[model samples]
Target: MAGRQPRRTRIGDAVVVLGVACGLALVGVSGCGRSGAATGGGGGGTTAGEVAAAVREAADALVDAGSSKARTSMEMATGGTRVTIRGEGVYDYRKRIGRLKVLLPQDPSGAPVSRPITELLAPGALFMKNRGAGVPANKWVRVDTGTLPDGNLVTGGVTDPFTAAELLRGARTATYVGRTEFAGVPVRHYRGTADLHEAAQAASEANRRTLGAAASEFATSEVPFDVYLDDQGRIRKVRHRFSFVNEERSAPVAVASTTLLHDFGAPVDVRLPEAEDIYAGRIAKE
Candidate 1:
């Protein structure tokens, strides 16, 4: 195993599988600026069609290293630091079954550090695989849905915008908007929304240790998402908005900011936790 690439690590529903086997893809996107040009259906990509095209081209077009992407605009907060963010990622979808590396670049003032993070968004079931520098490698070595490993507590499984769109099969329902250029390439735009209730429930249950303390029972609302696609039907941007109709502003902190998606993939270590049996009982095809 010394020379072999690490197998995947599963944490609840997500799996992080990595091996030298998959083809690597890498591309740089010239992110749009202030006009809201940086996200799924916002300021840039001059035309909705252009935004869609960028997604299609990247999803369909395989690079020698992998494909790259960025998130729609998102408000990010951790500890006491808050920043508006547009996360970016690269992946070899053709290889390793969508192996991906996502990064949040340095802020405009270069005051905050940019993080290059790696994660796998499984084709189904909201499963994920992830890794990043400075983070405890053990977190990625296996499935761990504890608090944010990086201490950046923005709870979300589809942290990357495009993946959120792709998971819902946005290509099928997305309506064409217009066109614009991203990273010097033309992109087509599209939109769609699907429920993340199931994933959310799973996450809440997986982290039951913390959520269990809530004094009141909870009901989840339907999640509405804004999505974007390219010409070839590849997802470019995703915007997920969760509304809690039952809870008030006084609800648990996690109810407002945490996410539930966890890792699902091949096992990286030979020694399995006693909890492995629990995962084995899960309905998994990957």
Candidate 2:
């Protein structure tokens, strides 16, 4: 706990943000048969435009699917420590409600810990439960995404289905990776690499967290995408892998995540934790 604590914290923050982005991306919209057989190939048979169109179609379908459950897994390596997170949750984009149970790495005492968090989109707030990390154990801190000092909370736009569609629409080099089975369902895979600058620019205005240099810096890091669509052209899974060097450090941190979307168009119920379960003191942001 004594060596390079701040740096490790930054790494943890980076990975956590990435995990949330991926998780949010997993629960939006759902649709069936949007992908067609006529344009499902990856190599000589498919063009970038076709692939982009397919992605856009799938994105729209997902949005239409309304509510669904998600299972997310993330892995990160920073310096010498490696950590993994597993999460399961239900999200209703139409109603802007979500509940998540995120399993974190073990504590210093070797006990497992987790952040049981929920989002009440009506007021655009994120409620995070305090684990035993110095904060009161019985209270849930409310973080108003709209009031954050930085535009960081707005990064949710990066995971928005429309934003994702816009990003794919700008992809000049997309290829069909061919048809395969994913999660026991037949799917067509497509791979695309978008220019970081263009990808950042393509984010919907509503989803843009910051403008100018900040946005450019976000794009400065490449985003390699692997998109999977079921037989009906409905999106079944999406994976993003990104890596960058921190400041002047040559050692790089890499993050990889995968999100699977299923149980499309399901009815969802998201209730806030009971008042008794919430702490009345000032909520601390973890």
Candidate 3:
């Protein structure tokens, strides 16, 4: 908000440890299992081309719906410890903005480490309050999404709802899993892998640069996902498995991010913090 530049802090750095452990665990488990293949009863006859095309159009479908309430979950596991971060919010597709209250997991002793963080997600920026590492609780820390590795995808812990759906634009391989009910609504499930580079090429102008940054910084450009689409082709639920290199560990970190959209056409009002309300001082590392 202020004209002064905030200290450059990599959001990804705070979550790197969780990523490394989760990535290693995923690799070990994957080696013992069969390839990820679609399984279920509905839409078995749908062709791969048809499924891919339908999945790719899901993002546009959401825009047509206007807005929705969203719930997000991000899980990371290493060794035997698994932690999950949860968020609930509302998003406006037309305006490309949303507000989420994110709760961090409890400490090992089952004690709360901090209060829930309030996050405002906009086109190219992220604003957070109660972020806690030496910052005033009343001030917000703003980060440019385009400057973040993974394009603020895994870096923010909770992937932005709009970006999660837009990622489907790059769907390269897909199989119809079947018909299912999500939040009491009928939906068709599809599973596939998307190329981040291709998604960046097809993404809207506001998201192109952010996603392109992710494509170049992640350990791999390919993202695996499972998505559920309603009758109108709107996304009911989507889950993305992201991998990024943890420089210190010299290994990839794996994060499973899930987003659920419902209450279509819900009212959403998100206001960005004023320049005077933003903290421009140096932020301490987590």
Candidate 4:
């Protein structure tokens, strides 16, 4: 017992296991084509107001489109180590629900360390199977998104698609980077910063509390993002940079989360687990 780590410390460390393991480098994407560039107030005949308005309206546009197939990547860096987690699924924007198969990185030896986790994203809750550690293989662990320090944004290893789009509603300052082609589709690129508190204020009732919690707990409330929108104003892709305090080292951890949506009108069917199948016991820390 002399050299044993306390339970609290172990749990705190486990909280970031998915975020801190060594893994592949974050992928970089480049855009093709260019129209005009603008920054701040106005340039190239584009106004800051216009850019902000377009970015802010993206979420509503997604909802109107109905549903889409999505891919997500979250890269976290801390203490000089970086890791990436990737997920793919379909989301029904109108229903505010989705299902994703999240894949954790393999070990240093290239051996699979864990099975893919099945995650269900609902308005205010997150449900997961193969959650690792103490959770039974057949039972799902359910978490209230609003109770997480990062509002489940960075905690669950992948940002919820709806929440990611809603964050754009807080866009305060934006610049039209130029016109570009994303995944072979023509789109307008924009770079901007969003205030978490402002986003929470503009968010739907189900998301307000979660975003509010993130606003108060993250290292800073201002989130920097790059967004790509098609002619219909739907978000083709979005990437957000967030920072949060790491409880173990008392330092800030940098996180970069990317979401890509395609095939609008795609069918999505997500059913939450039954109450009896949810895990209610204390989770063990690895």
lDDT of each: 0.30, 0.48, 0.73, 0.74
Per-residue C-alpha lDDT of model 1 across residues 74-168, encoded as one tens digit per residue:
44333234444333333333332233334443544555553444444322212223333223433443333233221111223234322332223
List the candidate 4 regions with Cα displacement exceeding 4 Å.
Answer: 1-45, 109-111
Sliding window of 10 residues with minimal summed lDDT for model 3: 24-33
Tens-place lDDT per residue, model 4, 1-286, is 1011112222244355333254211000111112223222223234766676677777877887899999999887755867778999999988999999998866656776588889999989988898776788999998888777667777677889989988888877788899889999878888888878888888877688888877776545678899988877788999998654444655555668999999999999899999999999976544
Off by over 4 Å in 2: 1-45, 107-109, 114-125, 144-172, 195-206, 210-221, 244-250, 271-286
In angstroms, the error of model 2 at 16 is 7.8
Per-residue lDDT tens digits of candidate 3, residues 1-286?
A: 1011112234346453122223321011101122212222333236775676677777777787899999999886644577788899999987899999987777667665568888999999888888877789899988888987668786666888989987888777788998889889888888888877888888877788888887776546778899998777788899988644443443344568999999999999888999999999987755
Q: How far off is residue 82 in model 3, in Å?
A: 0.5
- Tell me the TM-score of model 1: 0.38
Give model 2's TM-score versus the native structure: 0.66
Q: What is the TM-score of each candidate against the true structure?
A: 0.38, 0.66, 0.84, 0.84
Sorted by lDDT (best first), the order is 4, 3, 2, 1
